[model samples]
Target: MEHRVSLITVGARDVETLAAFYEALGWTRVDSPDGVIAFDLLGQSLGIYPLAALADEIGVPESDLGHGAMALSHNVREKADVAPLLDRAQAAGGRLLKPAQDVFWGGHHGYFADPEGHIWEVAWNPFSALGPRGEFQWNGVG
Candidate 1:
């Protein structure tokens, strides 16, 4: 019951394709044990596994592996990076969900969906401070 997440695994319709997409974004991936692909993030690991495999491991039918209303995000160091990040996502076979724009909170952000329809928000929040390696911290500022 620690307040830390060790890993996050998503059901990818095509693990190979998803892995390729991430590699295209310059992410280095480590081969997974079976039916999965793993990428080491800052403080966690992102795992991509086949939907059917994940469902079977959970004793659920593949049909139950449905998409949910949520977004995974990556915060950037500068506002200028938002657009290029979105563009990179698109080039990597992702779809642009929202064009980069200035936000009321004084940030720049955009949204994109991976080939499996998992939404990701790329943002540059001026008020919040990121760690040395681009880890986000809620600065409690406007």
Candidate 2:
């Protein structure tokens, strides 16, 4: 199996709200009427679909799901950008899980949960290298 993730579809209670949140983050929604909205993220795609409908389409019972204890992270260019990015997340109806602060590993980071309880981390590491898409490449420095 390949070790690459090409798509990530998040089940949202309200597709419009979820779409709006991401749109506010500068993601443009591709036009689709299949009840699934997609956003292009660099080379990958992030999709939002209605929860129950998505489960039905996948042939899974919605009640059989477990808690979504996973988190998606976004890395920024500088440590000073952490707090402001976090503010944007909060302003977009996400709840603050952790205020931006220094981590034990010598980086600044924080967490926030989207309206649907999907956790997202915003972090800044001085020793990390970032690609043009703003993703971080950990070089084992800080």
Candidate 3:
């Protein structure tokens, strides 16, 4: 399998609400077929779908799908940009889970949870500066 991810889908209890939350975050929606709301990121697309439908398709109960154990990260180009972006998230209906602070790994970061409770980490990693188009690499862009 390729090492890159092409898409990330979130099963939401209310698709419209979750979609709106993302849209409020200044993400423009990409044209997708019915039942899925999609936003095209730098290298991948994020899709939001109905949680119950997702569970049914996977042949599992909705309760079996967990929401809190993982986090999606958004990396910034500078340390100073972290807190403001986190503030923007809060203004857009997301709950601030952690105020921005310097981490032991030498990064400045914070966390926020979307309306559906999906955790997101906003960070500025000096070791992994983003590309010109904002694509992220583990050890800085070549």
C-alpha local distance difference test of each model = 0.89, 0.85, 0.91
Which lDDT tens digits does candidate 3 get at residues 40-87?
A: 998899999899988998999999997859999999999999999999
Off by over 4 Å in 1: 140-142
Considering every candidate listed, which one attains the maximal TM-score? 3
- Kindly list the per-residue Cα lDDT of model 1 for residues 81-105, writing each as its tens digit: 9999999999999999999999997
Q: What is the descending lDDT order?
A: 3, 1, 2
**73 in model 2: Cα distance from truth in Å?**
0.2
Ranking by TM-score: 3, 1, 2
Global CA lDDT computed for model 2: 0.85
Q: What is the lDDT of residue 100 in candidate 1?
A: 99
Candidate 2, residue 4: CA error in Å? 1.6
Most accurate candidate by lDDT: 3
Worst 10 residues of 3 by lDDT: 29-38
